[model samples]
Target: MFKGFLTLRPSCEVCGLDYSFADPADGPAFFVICFACIPSVALAVWLEVAFEAPYWVHAFTTLPFMLLTCIPPLRPLKGWLVASQYFYKAEEGKLVRLETPRNDDLHPHSA
Candidate 1:
C-alpha cells in the first residue's frame, strides 16, 4: 500500500504475491473520466438550463456532485478494470502476418 502508486510492481495485500501481470495502464482512469465526467456534466447542464439555477447553486452542487461521482468510483472502477484484465488475460494487440497467399494471386492470368 505504501508503494502501490509509486511502483508498477506492487504486491497483493492479502496474498502477498507479486502483481507483475497487472498492467491496466490508464484504462481505468480513462473509463472513470469518460463515464463519470460525461454524465455528471450533462446532468449539471441540464439541471442548470431546466431549472434556471443560479451560478452559486450550480457551483456548490454540481462540482461537489461531480467530485463525488468520480472520486469514489474511481478506485473500484480501476480495480474492476484491472481485475478484469487479469481475469481475461488481456493483452495489447499484435500485428499478424499471413502465412499463405491466395491461389488467385499466383494464377491471376492463368484463367
Candidate 2:
C-alpha cells in the first residue's frame, strides 16, 4: 500500500486519518541495524570457533550468512515499524505551553 523512503500514499485505508503522522524516519533501518549486530557478531565468533578456519575462510564464511541475515527482513521490518507508527499515532513532540514571561510581566515594578 505504501511506497518510497518517505510516504507515497497520502491517506489511510480504514481510519481516514492523514498519512503524515506515519513518518517513521529511518526507524525500520535503525531497528534492522540494531538487530543485525547481534547475530553478525555471534556468527563471526561461531565461525572462528567451530571451523577453526583461517582469516580468508572467515571472510568467505561470514559474507554469505551476513547477506542471508541482513537482507531478508529489511522490508518487513520497515513495514511493521510504519504500521506501528500509524496505529499508535506516533509523532513529534508538541509545545504544550510557553512559560517564558513577557517583558512587562518580568518588570512589573518598572511598569
Candidate 3:
C-alpha cells in the first residue's frame, strides 16, 4: 500500500545514499507506516469504539497515538527522502555528483 503512495525513493542528495530496489531483503522503512504502526492505530480505533468516547476525547487521544506512531519512524523516512534527491554517476573510475532542486526551490510560490 505504501509502495504505491511513495512516488519517490529516499536518498541523500549530497552523499549519494541510494538503496537497492532490486534487493528483496530491503524491506520498507519502519517510519514509513508499515506493519508496526498499523497495530497501534488499530488499537486506538478500538479504544474509541469500545469506550464510546466523545468527539473531543477521540480527537485528543488520537494526537498522542499518532505522535507515538510517527516520531520514532521519522529518522529513516527523512534519510530516504534526502537520499532520493541525489545519485552517484561513475566516470573514469571516479564518482560524479548530481543534485535535484532543493525543496525550497520546488516550493517557491508557497507562503
Best candidate according to TM-score: 1
Instruction: Give one digit per residue, the lDDT tens place, for model 3 in 1-111.
Output: 123344334443566555443222233454346755676678678877899777787678776777677666655564454444323331224667888899898999885
Q: C-alpha displacement of 36 in model 3, angstroms? A: 4.8
Measured against the true structure, the TM-scores of the candidates, in listed sequence, are 0.72, 0.62, 0.38
Superposed model 2: Cα runs more than 4 Å off: 2-18, 49-51, 98-111
TM-score of 2: 0.62
Compared with the true structure, what per-residue lDDT tens digits does model 2 show for residues 1-111?
Answer: 466644446766776767666666777667767888578878899878887879888678787777777777777776687688868878888889878989999889995
Q: Comparing candidate 1 with candidate 2, which one achieves the higher lDDT? A: 1
Local distance difference test, each candidate: 0.76, 0.74, 0.55
Q: Rank the candidates by TM-score, best first.
A: 1, 2, 3
Question: How many steric clashes does model 3 contain?
Answer: 7
TM-score of 3: 0.38
Which ten contiguous residues of candidate 1 have the minimum total lDDT? 1-10
RMSD (Å) of each candidate, 1 decimal: 3.6, 4.5, 16.1
Return the top candidate by lDDT. Answer: 1
Superposed Cα deviation of residue 94, candidate 1 (Å): 1.9
Candidate 1, residues 1-111, lDDT tens digits: the string is 224432444777777766676776777678878988998899789988899899898899899989888877766666777678778988778999977978988899998
